[model samples]
Target: MDDTGLLVIVDAANVVGSVPDGWWRDRRGAAERLRDRLAAEGVPGHPGPVEIVLVTEGAARGVESVPGVLLDPAQGSGDDRMVDLVAEAGVFFFFFFFSDRELRRRVTSLGADVTGPRAVRPAGGAWAPRRDG
Candidate 1:
Protein backbone atom coordinates (compact mmCIF):
# COMPACT_ATOMS: atom_id res chain seq x y z
CA MET A 1 0.00 0.00 0.00
CA ASP A 2 1.12 3.59 -0.53
CA ASP A 3 2.02 4.83 2.95
CA THR A 4 1.97 8.43 1.87
CA GLY A 5 -1.67 8.00 1.01
CA LEU A 6 -2.33 7.29 4.67
CA LEU A 7 -3.52 9.93 7.13
CA VAL A 8 -2.91 9.50 10.88
CA ILE A 9 -5.21 11.41 13.20
CA VAL A 10 -3.95 11.21 16.76
CA ASP A 11 -5.64 12.05 20.06
CA ALA A 12 -2.78 13.99 21.61
CA ALA A 13 -4.21 14.15 25.11
CA ASN A 14 -5.16 10.50 25.16
CA VAL A 15 -1.81 9.45 23.71
CA VAL A 16 0.12 11.61 26.13
CA GLY A 17 -2.02 10.46 29.01
CA SER A 18 -1.37 6.83 28.03
CA VAL A 19 1.99 7.11 29.74
CA PRO A 20 2.34 8.05 33.41
CA ASP A 21 5.03 10.64 32.79
CA GLY A 22 3.83 13.43 35.02
CA TRP A 23 2.50 15.08 31.90
CA TRP A 24 0.06 16.87 34.14
CA ARG A 25 2.83 19.28 35.10
CA ASP A 26 4.04 20.39 31.68
CA ARG A 27 1.45 19.33 29.15
CA ARG A 28 2.84 21.56 26.44
CA GLY A 29 6.27 20.00 26.83
CA ALA A 30 4.81 16.52 26.70
CA ALA A 31 2.80 17.32 23.58
CA GLU A 32 5.83 18.92 21.96
CA ARG A 33 7.93 15.88 22.71
CA LEU A 34 5.25 13.66 21.18
CA ARG A 35 5.20 15.84 18.08
CA ASP A 36 8.99 15.73 17.68
CA ARG A 37 9.09 11.98 18.18
CA LEU A 38 6.31 11.49 15.65
CA ALA A 39 8.15 13.70 13.18
CA ALA A 40 11.24 11.56 13.68
CA GLU A 41 9.54 8.16 13.74
CA GLY A 42 6.57 8.72 11.43
CA VAL A 43 4.40 6.24 13.32
CA PRO A 44 5.23 2.52 13.73
CA GLY A 45 3.86 0.52 10.81
CA HIS A 46 3.39 3.49 8.49
CA PRO A 47 5.94 4.72 5.95
CA GLY A 48 7.07 8.05 5.04
CA PRO A 49 7.06 10.95 4.90
CA VAL A 50 3.78 10.01 6.46
CA GLU A 51 0.98 12.39 7.25
CA ILE A 52 0.17 12.97 10.95
CA VAL A 53 -2.59 15.09 12.46
CA LEU A 54 -2.30 15.48 16.20
CA VAL A 55 -5.30 16.80 18.15
CA THR A 56 -4.59 18.55 21.42
CA GLU A 57 -6.83 19.92 24.20
CA GLY A 58 -6.88 21.20 27.78
CA ALA A 59 -3.39 21.81 29.09
CA ALA A 60 -1.84 20.91 25.76
CA ARG A 61 -3.96 23.36 23.83
CA GLY A 62 -2.50 25.74 21.26
CA VAL A 63 0.25 23.37 20.12
CA GLU A 64 1.35 24.67 16.76
CA SER A 65 1.40 22.65 13.59
CA VAL A 66 4.69 22.16 11.83
CA PRO A 67 5.79 20.63 8.56
CA GLY A 68 4.80 16.96 8.47
CA VAL A 69 2.59 17.27 11.52
CA LEU A 70 -0.70 19.09 11.75
CA LEU A 71 -1.37 20.19 15.32
CA ASP A 72 -5.14 20.35 15.76
CA PRO A 73 -6.18 22.02 18.97
CA ALA A 74 -9.73 21.15 19.90
CA GLN A 75 -11.97 24.04 20.86
CA GLY A 76 -13.74 21.91 23.43
CA SER A 77 -13.11 18.19 23.53
CA GLY A 78 -10.34 16.38 21.74
CA ASP A 79 -12.49 13.29 21.45
CA ASP A 80 -15.13 15.20 19.57
CA ARG A 81 -12.51 16.63 17.22
CA MET A 82 -11.20 13.14 16.57
CA VAL A 83 -14.69 12.02 15.67
CA ASP A 84 -14.99 14.88 13.24
CA LEU A 85 -11.67 13.95 11.68
CA VAL A 86 -12.75 10.38 11.22
CA ALA A 87 -15.98 11.49 9.73
CA GLU A 88 -14.17 13.76 7.32
CA ALA A 89 -11.29 11.45 6.36
CA GLY A 90 -10.91 10.18 2.84
CA VAL A 91 -11.15 6.54 1.81
CA PHE A 92 -7.45 5.80 2.37
CA PHE A 93 -7.06 7.63 5.65
CA PHE A 94 -6.92 5.92 9.06
CA PHE A 95 -7.34 6.98 12.67
CA PHE A 96 -4.96 6.49 15.63
CA PHE A 97 -5.83 6.94 19.27
CA PHE A 98 -4.81 5.67 22.71
CA SER A 99 -7.68 4.33 24.85
CA ASP A 100 -10.98 6.08 24.63
CA ARG A 101 -13.64 3.41 24.35
CA GLU A 102 -16.32 5.75 23.12
CA LEU A 103 -13.92 7.23 20.60
CA ARG A 104 -12.99 3.81 19.35
CA ARG A 105 -16.65 3.05 18.80
CA ARG A 106 -17.25 6.31 16.99
CA VAL A 107 -14.22 6.03 14.68
CA THR A 108 -14.84 2.39 13.93
CA SER A 109 -18.45 3.16 13.16
CA LEU A 110 -17.14 5.47 10.48
CA GLY A 111 -15.35 2.51 8.86
CA ALA A 112 -11.92 3.81 9.79
CA ASP A 113 -9.07 1.67 11.05
CA VAL A 114 -7.80 2.55 14.51
CA THR A 115 -4.71 1.80 16.58
CA GLY A 116 -3.28 2.61 19.97
CA PRO A 117 -0.79 5.28 21.04
CA ARG A 118 1.97 2.71 20.66
CA ALA A 119 1.58 3.39 16.97
CA VAL A 120 3.45 6.63 17.73
CA ARG A 121 5.91 5.33 20.36
CA PRO A 122 6.57 2.23 22.42
CA ALA A 123 5.31 3.89 25.65
CA GLY A 124 7.67 5.19 28.34
CA GLY A 125 10.74 7.36 28.26
CA ALA A 126 10.95 10.95 29.47
CA TRP A 127 7.30 11.62 28.67
CA ALA A 128 7.52 13.39 32.01
CA PRO A 129 9.04 16.73 32.81
CA ARG A 130 12.40 17.12 34.55
CA ARG A 131 12.71 19.52 37.44
CA ASP A 132 16.03 20.85 38.68
CA GLY A 133 16.84 21.49 42.29
Candidate 2:
Protein backbone atom coordinates (compact mmCIF):
# COMPACT_ATOMS: atom_id res chain seq x y z
CA MET A 1 0.00 0.00 0.00
CA ASP A 2 2.74 2.44 1.01
CA ASP A 3 4.92 3.52 -1.85
CA THR A 4 7.92 4.48 0.28
CA GLY A 5 10.88 2.15 0.37
CA LEU A 6 11.49 0.32 3.66
CA LEU A 7 14.72 -0.01 5.54
CA VAL A 8 14.76 -2.66 8.25
CA ILE A 9 17.54 -2.36 10.76
CA VAL A 10 18.13 -5.30 13.05
CA ASP A 11 19.89 -4.62 16.33
CA ALA A 12 21.70 -7.91 16.51
CA ALA A 13 22.34 -7.97 20.24
CA ASN A 14 18.99 -6.58 21.17
CA VAL A 15 17.20 -9.05 18.94
CA VAL A 16 19.19 -11.90 20.40
CA GLY A 17 18.06 -10.74 23.84
CA SER A 18 14.44 -10.66 22.78
CA VAL A 19 14.09 -14.40 23.19
CA PRO A 20 15.15 -16.48 26.16
CA ASP A 21 16.81 -19.06 23.97
CA GLY A 22 20.26 -18.31 25.39
CA TRP A 23 21.40 -16.64 22.18
CA TRP A 24 24.07 -14.81 24.11
CA ARG A 25 25.88 -18.10 24.51
CA ASP A 26 26.48 -18.12 20.79
CA ARG A 27 26.46 -14.56 19.54
CA ARG A 28 27.82 -15.20 16.08
CA GLY A 29 25.55 -18.17 15.60
CA ALA A 30 22.53 -16.12 16.60
CA ALA A 31 23.50 -13.26 14.30
CA GLU A 32 24.09 -15.65 11.46
CA ARG A 33 20.80 -17.35 12.08
CA LEU A 34 18.95 -14.07 12.08
CA ARG A 35 20.68 -13.02 8.89
CA ASP A 36 19.86 -16.31 7.26
CA ARG A 37 16.26 -16.05 8.33
CA LEU A 38 15.99 -12.62 6.80
CA ALA A 39 17.69 -13.82 3.66
CA ALA A 40 15.58 -16.92 3.24
CA GLU A 41 14.69 -17.23 -0.44
CA GLY A 42 11.07 -17.15 -1.66
CA VAL A 43 9.55 -16.10 1.67
CA PRO A 44 6.13 -14.51 1.36
CA GLY A 45 4.49 -11.28 2.55
CA HIS A 46 7.40 -8.84 2.44
CA PRO A 47 6.23 -5.46 1.31
CA GLY A 48 7.71 -3.53 -1.60
CA PRO A 49 11.34 -2.45 -1.81
CA VAL A 50 12.40 -3.67 1.63
CA GLU A 51 16.04 -3.41 2.64
CA ILE A 52 17.42 -5.14 5.72
CA VAL A 53 20.44 -4.12 7.72
CA LEU A 54 22.03 -5.83 10.70
CA VAL A 55 23.79 -3.79 13.36
CA THR A 56 25.93 -5.43 15.99
CA GLU A 57 28.65 -4.53 18.44
CA GLY A 58 31.91 -5.78 17.03
CA ALA A 59 30.13 -8.20 14.79
CA ALA A 60 31.22 -6.47 11.60
CA ARG A 61 34.87 -6.56 12.59
CA GLY A 62 36.08 -8.59 9.64
CA VAL A 63 33.00 -8.61 7.48
CA GLU A 64 32.69 -5.74 5.04
CA SER A 65 29.29 -6.19 3.46
CA VAL A 66 26.59 -8.78 3.02
CA PRO A 67 24.98 -9.47 -0.34
CA GLY A 68 21.41 -8.52 0.43
CA VAL A 69 22.06 -6.76 3.74
CA LEU A 70 24.25 -4.16 5.36
CA LEU A 71 26.39 -5.08 8.35
CA ASP A 72 27.41 -2.36 10.77
CA PRO A 73 29.69 -2.80 13.77
CA ALA A 74 28.94 -0.47 16.61
CA GLN A 75 32.05 1.30 17.78
CA GLY A 76 30.59 1.73 21.26
CA SER A 77 26.96 0.71 21.12
CA GLY A 78 24.79 -0.74 18.45
CA ASP A 79 22.08 1.72 19.35
CA ASP A 80 24.20 4.58 18.08
CA ARG A 81 24.79 2.84 14.81
CA MET A 82 21.13 2.04 14.45
CA VAL A 83 20.17 5.62 15.05
CA ASP A 84 22.76 6.76 12.59
CA LEU A 85 21.39 4.40 9.99
CA VAL A 86 17.87 5.64 10.51
CA ALA A 87 19.04 9.21 10.20
CA GLU A 88 21.01 8.50 7.07
CA ALA A 89 18.33 6.45 5.40
CA GLY A 90 16.42 9.17 3.62
CA VAL A 91 12.85 8.61 2.47
CA PHE A 92 12.52 4.95 3.35
CA PHE A 93 10.36 2.96 5.76
CA PHE A 94 12.79 2.50 8.63
CA PHE A 95 12.33 -0.39 11.05
CA PHE A 96 14.64 -1.37 13.85
CA PHE A 97 14.52 -3.97 16.57
CA PHE A 98 12.91 -2.15 19.48
CA SER A 99 14.42 -3.04 22.86
CA ASP A 100 14.92 0.30 24.62
CA ARG A 101 12.16 2.84 24.82
CA GLU A 102 14.62 5.71 24.89
CA LEU A 103 16.23 4.57 21.68
CA ARG A 104 12.82 4.14 20.11
CA ARG A 105 12.01 7.73 21.00
CA ARG A 106 15.24 8.88 19.45
CA VAL A 107 14.55 7.02 16.21
CA THR A 108 11.01 8.38 16.04
CA SER A 109 12.41 11.84 16.57
CA LEU A 110 14.49 11.30 13.46
CA GLY A 111 11.35 10.47 11.49
CA ALA A 112 12.00 6.78 10.96
CA ASP A 113 9.62 3.90 11.60
CA VAL A 114 10.48 1.28 14.19
CA THR A 115 9.68 -2.35 14.74
CA GLY A 116 10.19 -5.21 17.17
CA PRO A 117 12.71 -7.63 18.51
CA ARG A 118 9.96 -10.25 18.41
CA ALA A 119 10.14 -13.48 16.51
CA VAL A 120 10.02 -12.60 12.80
CA ARG A 121 7.37 -14.74 11.17
CA PRO A 122 7.94 -16.22 7.74
CA ALA A 123 5.48 -13.78 6.23
CA GLY A 124 7.51 -10.78 7.31
CA GLY A 125 8.28 -8.77 10.45
CA ALA A 126 6.35 -6.28 12.57
CA TRP A 127 6.77 -2.58 11.74
CA ALA A 128 5.16 0.67 12.80
CA PRO A 129 5.14 4.00 11.02
CA ARG A 130 7.33 6.74 12.46
CA ARG A 131 4.83 9.58 12.43
CA ASP A 132 1.43 8.06 11.88
CA GLY A 133 -0.45 6.29 14.65
Give me the candidate number with maximum lDDT.
1
- Writing each residue's lDDT as its tens digit, candidate 1 over 1-133 gives 2545877888888887877768878888889888877877777766644568999998888788877789999999888888888776656568676678888988888887888776675555445355657
Clashes of each: 0, 0
Off by over 4 Å in 1: 1-4, 123-133
Error of 2 at 34 (Å): 0.5
* lDDT scores of the candidates, listed in order: 0.78, 0.65
The lowest-lDDT stretch of 10 consecutive residues in candidate 2 is 121-130
lDDT of 2 at 95: 69
